[model samples]
Target: MKGTETKAPGVPQALVDLVGDHFLEAARYLREIQDAYPKEFVSVAKKLKVGRRKAYELVRIDRRFHDLGIAPERLRQIGWTKLAHLASHVDADNVEKWLALAETVTAHELKMLLRGTVIDPETRAVVLYLDKVQYGIFETALLTAGAIKDSGCLLNREAALTRLLDGVVVE
Candidate 1:
C-alpha cells in the first residue's frame, strides 16, 4: 500500500490544516488536566464539553502511545481508532509492523486481527464520514445501483462499490 493514498476528498485544505492531528493535541491537553486534577479528571473531561467516553478513550490512547514513545507523526498516520486496537500489542520492537498493518486494514478488521481472527490479506477498507443529506444520497445511489443489500452488511457494500468501480473508465 505504499503508493496508495489516504484522501479526504471534498474537504477543504484549510480545514484540514486547521484540524491537523487534533486528537493528538486533545490527548496531551486531557493528560495535563488529568495530572493536575487526578480525582476530578472525569468531571473535568465532562466540563470540557466532550463526551466522557471519548475523553477517556483519548486519555488511554495518549498514555499508552506516550509511554511507548510512539511519535506523533506515526500516531497521526495510523489514526486514533486503529491505534486503539494496536495500543496493547505495539511496542518499540513491533511498532513499525503494527503501524503498517493498521495502515493497510480498517479499524474493524484490525480489531478482529488483534483477537486472533484470520482476515484476507488482499481485503482493503475505506471509511467515510457523511452528513445526513450526503448519506441519504449515497445510500440511495448504492441502493439504486444494487450495491447495498437488504441486510446492508459492510462486505456486501464493499463488493458493490468494487463492482461499480470496475465498470468506470478513468482517464
Candidate 2:
C-alpha cells in the first residue's frame, strides 16, 4: 500500500512553494503508515491506541494513504449505526455530521472540496491573513477540509478552518 504519487503537472510555483518541505515530510509519514498497515485502519487504530473515531479523524484529515485501509467496499458495508459507533469513540456530534455530509457527497466532490474553495470569500481572506503568521496553519486547513469532505464528519471544524487564509496558496 504505497502512496501513489500525486504529481499534478504544471502545478503553480506558488502552490509548490507552499507545499515545501513539510508536505514531503507528511507524505513520508503517510507512506510509512501505509506500508505498515496496508488497508487495515481498524487494526492500525488499535495499535496506535486511537479510538475508532480518532482513526476516522486521522483518515479524514489525510487521504494520501487513506486507500491503505478502509476500502470503498468496506465503507459501503458499514451501516450508519456501526459508523456512528466508530465515530462516537471520538466525537458523537462529528459522527452525525460526517454521516450526513457523506450522504450528499461523492468521492469526486470530496476531492474537489479538499483542494478547491468551499468557504466564502471573506472568511477565506481572513484565514489567508492569519496564515501569514504561521504557514503550517494553511496546510492544516486544507487537510481538515479534506477530512470533513471525505469523512463527512469533523469535530473542531471551526478550529480546523481557522487555519486557512484567503487567497493563500497551500500545496
Candidate 3:
C-alpha cells in the first residue's frame, strides 16, 4: 500500500533497492507469461527457481500495489510475509494507516494484530457429506498425519473430523 516514503529502519539500503528492482522485473515477466499461455504459471514459477506460493506473492505485490495502495518501494521493504498478511487489509484509504502501523510494530506483532483470532478453532466448525471413498482416503491421510486417537483409531466420520484442519491453513 502507498504510504509516506521513507527507508525502513535496520536493513541495508542496498538490499532494499535490489528488492524493488527484482520484484518489478519478476512481476513484469510473470504477467507476460500468464498473458501468453494462461496455464503456464507453474512452468514460469519453476523456471524462476521459486515456489508457486512465492511466485504468487511476488505477482500480488506487483499487480495489486495500486489496488492495495502501496508504493512499490515500500512494498519491497516490508518483505513477503507481511505483504501477504496486509493484502487482506489494504485499500485506498487505509493503506497509509496500515503502513504507518506496520512501521511502528515488530513483524510478529503486526501479524498478530492482523490475524486477530479469526481462525481460532474453538470458534469454528463445519459439516459436510463425503462420499465413501473420499471418507476412506481422508481417514487414512489423517491416520498417517497422526491426527488419530491415542489408541490409534478414529470413527469413520471422526477421521476427517479430528483436527482435519488442525494445523492446516488453506490460505
Clashes of each: 0, 10, 5
What would the per-residue lDDT of candidate 3 be over residues 1-171, giving only the tens digit for each residue?
Answer: 455443322323443344444665666566556656556777666666668877777677556564554566676676566766676687777878877877776565677678683333344336659999997887678776656455545634344555566657666
- Please rank every candidate by TM-score, starting with the best: 1, 3, 2
Superior candidate under TM-score, 2 versus 3: 3
* TM per prediction: 0.54, 0.20, 0.51
Model 1 scores a TM of: 0.54
How far residue 125's Cα lies from its native spot in candidate 2, in Å, is 28
User: Clashing pairs in model 2?
Assistant: 39-68, 39-69, 60-147, 98-152, 98-153, 124-166, 127-164, 127-165, 128-165, 128-166
Question: What is candidate 2's lDDT per residue for 12-33, written digit by digit as tens?
Answer: 3443343322333223333355
Worst-scoring 10-residue span by lDDT in model 1: 6-15
Q: Mark the regions of model 2 whose C-alpha exceeds 4 Å error after superposition.
A: 1-90, 114-116, 119-171
Pairs of residues clashing in candidate 1: none
Among these predictions, the greatest TM-score belongs to 1
